[model samples]
Target: MRPFRATVFAAVVLAAVSVSVPVAAAAPGSGSSLPGAGPAVHPDNAALDCPDLLVVAVSGATDSTADRNPIEEETRQLWSNWVGNITVPVGEAKSRYPGSVGWMYVPYPATYGLGLFQDVPTYQDSVAAGVASTNRILDEQKTRCGDRTRFALVGYSVGGEVVERVARELGHRPADAHVGPDDVAGVVLIGDPYRPAGVDSLGAPGPSGGGFMSSEPADYGDLTDRIQHACRPYDIACDAPEEIAVLELALGVLGQMRFTLANPLQTIADAERVVSTMAARAAAHIVSGDDWWQSDESLLDVLRVVADKTRPVPDANLGPDRLREILDWAVGPGLPVVQEKLRAEGAGFVEDNSGVVELVLKPYIFLAFIQHIAYWNNNPHDPWYWESEKIVDWIGALAQEERERDSVGN
Candidate 1:
């Protein structure tokens, strides 16, 4: 499979909550996927510049080791990437953040971590913790920066679902939990599993809702469909799996991409090769070791296999030049092609839950590939062409809206 990459925006400040700022919010999945506890947000819109954004990441699928590492790496990468990406040049200011871009996630126990991935219970707990942490971050920001700060949200994959839940909670903040009107600029849900009703500007959601939730990478019957329909202009197979943490993850339990390149394996094929090698080496090491110090023959094989197996398949190019390339792709122009490709690819991608969980075992095998698929098909940062143009437009529009809102109120 090829590596495809895609990657979105926002800004708002505290206003009198007079004019209704229409924006898409995230809604959580119920049943087994639903996390426990409700997030707490207070309606404090007294800040000056703009509202901070709440960025939530999903592990993709499964709750295991393979998914965790990538998530942490992705987060660090994303933060650095976005911090730089969002930093508008004086001339480019009006292009992206017509208003201002400020966002944050509360870092509760597991709410906001360097990288995150987990089971349903762990998810719920994390959500609860995030809500608490989000509140804390906002409160802290408010204390230091003042109240009434505008905000927005970006949820990746299952992380998108978490974002949805938070958005819904934010929208329906109990009388006690209140936030400003444009507190959330928009919920940029990338590869979400489920799309709640009445959302504005919802990104890609698969047959099972909206997200890159694959039972497993090996079970990619739908991938071809997604490529054919979602990425028509370019070759989806040639894009690159490494991009998915920004491409497909942001939803899985481990959110391997979010793991901050914690356990990067470049591509699924590469992952398979690496793990296969690890398994072989581990087996040989155990079998030949005469000393009991390296013993434990009974479980050594299983441990070796599992260890080698739990690695995400992403093509991480953390090199300075590559990172710069990504930034360039994100900021440059000509997005219609990418957007159209995504629409086509995303429209055709299929979803089959048949033993998918068992196959994917957290979907690490193809996390890299899927991430590329999801993003190239939908994200604005796709390098295949000038896809970033659409993002620039969106940012310009949002900034204009905010400026208008502020001007009128003043």
Candidate 2:
């Protein structure tokens, strides 16, 4: 395989550093009560308040526990790769406010396993489980703590995506939602794959590009201003360049494949969309007499292989062979015309920055791996600053505000 193709394949497979055991579902708020719990009172009567601020956190892929036992207060304090970042901050904020602040780290699969060679849940399945479990906790807390209690959400890596999804749902305030935008104090995300483009990172300037999975601007409705996203530069999870069509398509294809067994119909639909989009782009390139047809041809080759191997037929009866025949007829004969057009265009679409792409491609992907994992301790640009500290301070300040609010209300 060519260097670019080889690098792309490796990056997609190892994207986000996959490996995790599936976590069992635990009942919401199954953990012990917060410190300085008030006397038991009906939630409908009035605020049965103890903790004025609740910090709900979710850890990243492979950084969470599979055990469903109630997380003891002391165990919750133990340091972890990503969750430790939030816990230390929550602990600090709690110490300052005494019995006025509380926290819970939602437990879920937190896995990104491909499931191709293992029995573990896929990234898609893990994320969905995380979202479900996190929301269950949020719902339970809202009812138990009443409207007076405020919440701050924190998540890192895949956990960040989980939190982002939960926040988006809460922002929309669906009929079944237990928590709304008003109930949230703030949200903090680190190395989130769904981080939108152009949004300002917490402390420093973020990347020019958006997340690999979602490059478009995010909409959080009323919760928009209450959230803070911290993404390191070149972290492919949150800063993939739009110019790299190969990377995007590969991620889409692989990500969809992760959940194929869980939802085959959705997988077929998603695969069809990918192929159709590439087909359209290829046609446009050919019709416009663009020299980029070569690049498109390379991409089509990849899609063809995916279509051939996956045999993603909308109708199972059509059979993989039939689909392969259709794709062959669509692109095989047209290649000659595309090449002729390329020749007519003369020196078509020479990549002015081909060397740059080659030089940075592998390193960029490598850096993304390092940068995504290192947000807990390392900051490449500055050693004096850490993203975790920013989070700690933010959570502390929010907790203080919640404490003060409760004091005023009393």
Best by TM-score: 2
Candidate 1 residues 7-89, lDDT tens each? 31111111112112111111222112112223321122112233332222233222112112211222321222221122222
Model 1 local distance difference test score: 0.33
The lDDT of model 2 is 0.61
What is candidate 2's lDDT per residue for 62-96, written digit by digit as tens?
66644422133323212234555455545654664
Worst 10 residues of 1 by lDDT: 10-19
**Could you give me the TM-score of model 1 versus the true structure?**
0.37
Candidate 1 segments whose C-alpha is farther than 4 A from its true place? 1-92, 95-99, 105-124, 139-148, 174-177, 180-182, 196-368, 372-392
Q: Find the 10 residues in a row with the least total lDDT in model 2.
A: 40-49
lDDT of 2 at 400: 80
Q: After superposition, how far is residue 222 of candidate 2 from its true place, in Å?
A: 0.5
How far is each candidate from the true structure, as Cα RMSD in Å? 21.6, 10.4
